[model samples]
Target: MPAEDILRIEGVSMQFTGGAGLFGRRNRTTVRAVDEVNLSVRKGETLGLVGESGCGKTTLGRCILRAHKPSHGRILYRRDDGTEVDLAALSRAQLRPLRTEIRTVFQDPNSSLNPRMTVQQIVGEPLVVNGLARGSEVADRVADTLRRCGLRPELMRRYPHAFSGGERQRIGIARALVTQPRLVVADEAVSALDVSVRSQILNLLEDLQEELDLTYVFISHDLSVIQHLCDRVAVMYLGRIVEEAETEDLFEQPRHPYTEALLRSVPRPDPRLRRRDDVLPAGEVPAPDEAFAGCRFQPRCRYAEDICAREEPATLPRCHFAEDLTLDGVYATDVRQTS
Candidate 1:
């Protein structure tokens, strides 16, 4: 682990068992939602987790937050005082204090915020629950947080129903920030908003990060958004990370076939440069319950060969012909022109 890293996810995995037959016999099926994922988040850096739906990005985020207990592995988190603690081993009571240091901004603002609770209650709940503030002090802190999120303090008394989509998202941000968390996991934070509103939220997040010295785990399927917001990115596919690199490098010179396909799928603004044929893999993602002896992506990967189907690839960089193949990335001209 790097000395500067605030969070370290070491070989983490999550499995869920379900499906019962009519006779009440346990089907005994297990789905590995997160599969031995190793990642690190440096202090004050936004690490974007990007992938297609059902790729376990959300599951990994939940595991980091201890919202879902991992089936195996450790999550080490560093405190403000420079003490490292194993979050995976902490009890619920022990985790209570740590909750203030790690918060989450959910995807659907409408569904996340309580319509019955006023913004003041929504944002101040964390402070009150944690016994960090009481009475008028909570209100004062809520007002300050609202203002920081570009919302009027007077709107603090209003219910979620009174706010627009953007306003509701701001309220969510205010709520997440009320605890003054060191690390935040924003799970599709802007995916549900309008394009304009998404930009506004993204900018607001960036400003808040600078002002508060916050570290973020930004999880989203939107590659464009990831490119815009993240310093580094990890691309997940079927519960495993296929590629991770600096944002510019990952977009400009993707090493993994999956990464290349994802980059190619991005719409080019220039009609002349637009891709005519689909560059994506042909088949659907494999089911989590299905066991695969070889590379899970082999069935869909156009670059896959007999070896790819015969042996399971190690979870390391360039596991299969990474140096030999020159995978395509978004053209530098297209990126420059767009920027």
Candidate 2:
């Protein structure tokens, strides 16, 4: 049987309204960080959300974890018991119990970790807050989780200040996994680590997923990293998903112009295979609040036509010319910098 959809995000959009203009005298600014996005994440698969910075990758991930209540749409999450819940519609109290089954690994290791807390305290914090464990049990669970992430159990007493960047990230992973979450939303989880350490963390994540049968929503702007770890790819642009396909399929034959431009931006270490024919997307990313009558990527899309600016393409491979355009992708070249 095919894997079931663990999470279904339907027409989810998150908007933020901020302070009045420059001198605190103008109209309030409205920023739609996450526009209408629909995605289905299968069980045990890593669904990668990729795009340029400020393209709403993190915002979408936050919406998934319910860290940000979407301004519109349903976030249908299926629990282990097979009961489905609309996370977007739930109150904080109702969502509290569900949080144990859904977790997040944040971007910055240093900032994400509590400076004053010990490794044990940090990793065990969730277990304690959720009433999953207490006293000596929390300690034991913390130690095991640390060991699972490649850290020594003895280091549990030490502070986050003592570990290297990679080790600190390991602790972050442990904390997220401590709840034994079925769905993990990792927002730029490995971006802060050194190249050498990135693969190690990536490898650890893969191992943990296999052992726990975990499903991940991996959010990152780094296509190289996305290709390395994800089973499927969703390309976002200007707060909307433009394309989504199996990892290799999207990398080998991107149908959307935005996806193609993103693939073109990936550096090829071997000069012989570098893609010379493709041009990266030009023009600044439009302001978040800017209205788009048709395609959001029309301004930067090379394949865009007159109709593209007048008619909004439906959500599939969101491009007016997608069927006709044989857009380039990361061909034979290896995009990963780390071995």
Candidate 3:
């Protein structure tokens, strides 16, 4: 691990086992949510993980947070004391002490937040659980956090139902930050908000990041938002990262075919910048159990060839096509690019 890298995931894979029927008949199928993924997050930097729904972005984030036990490999968390611990191997008791150092702000505020608890209790619970403060001390801390998150201190007595989507999200942020976590996995934190509110939340997140010197694993399917907020971006397809590069490098010159397709599909903010309508590949995304031998994307890739069908292409090094393909108003032209 580099000195600057605070978190590292090595060959992390997660699979879920399911049962079918009332008799608890076991289903033999294994859904590989995250497969042999490797990533690192530098201290105080935001790494955006973007992919379509069911592409394993959320699962990867959860695995890092130890919300899901990884089936294979390890997640290493480096502490300020210059020591590293494998989060995957930690027992619940061992992990309890580290919980305050890492936290998650889920996509749905209503579902993630405790509906039964008042805002004050919800935010102050972390302090109590971590033994950081008690009674009046916790209340004061919660009130301070609420104010920092832009929530009214008086609203601490209210329930989540009384808040708007944006307000609820603010409450979620307050709860997550009240623990004074060093790393936060924000899984599509603003995806459900209205367009106007989205930017406000984004700005707020940026401000919080600066104030806290936080490291983030920001997950979303929105490239525009990712491009704006993330220092670097990783594009995942079918449980594998197809490309990982700096944000500007990615948007200016995407290397992977799947990444190019995704970039082309982004809706233009200005009408004048909109180009011709591009082609969308036919057929649905492949099933997780399909047993693919080569590249999982060959079925839907426009530039797929014999090699793509017979062998998986290494995500490194770029490929080129002789002709340009219009994909959802973005032009994909032949070019040799590198990370």
Model 1 lDDT, full chain set:
0.90
* Candidate 2 residue-wise lDDT, 199-232, digit = tens: 9999999999999999999999888999999999
Cα error, residue 45 of model 1, in Å, equals 0.4
Model 2 stretches astray by more than 4 angstroms? 1-3, 21-24, 273-278, 332-339
- Give the CA lDDT, 0 to 100, for residue 158 in model 2: 96
In lDDT terms, how accurate is model 2? 0.90
Best by TM-score: 1
Worst 10 residues of 1 by lDDT: 330-339
- Which segments of candidate 1 are over 4 A away from where they belong? 276-278, 332-339
Q: C-alpha displacement of 217 in model 2, angstroms?
A: 0.3
Q: For residues 150-239, could you state the per-residue lDDT of candidate 3 as single tens digits?
A: 888987998999999999999999999998899999999999899989998999999999998999899999888898899999888888
RMSD of 1: 2.9
Candidates' C-alpha lDDT: 0.90, 0.90, 0.84
- After superposition on all CA atoms, what RMSD does each candidate show versus the true structure? 2.9, 3.6, 4.8
**Candidate 1 lDDT, 248-278, residue by residue in tens:** 9988899888888888888777765755244
Location of the lowest summed lDDT over 10 successive residues in candidate 3? 320-329
lDDT of 2 at 68: 91
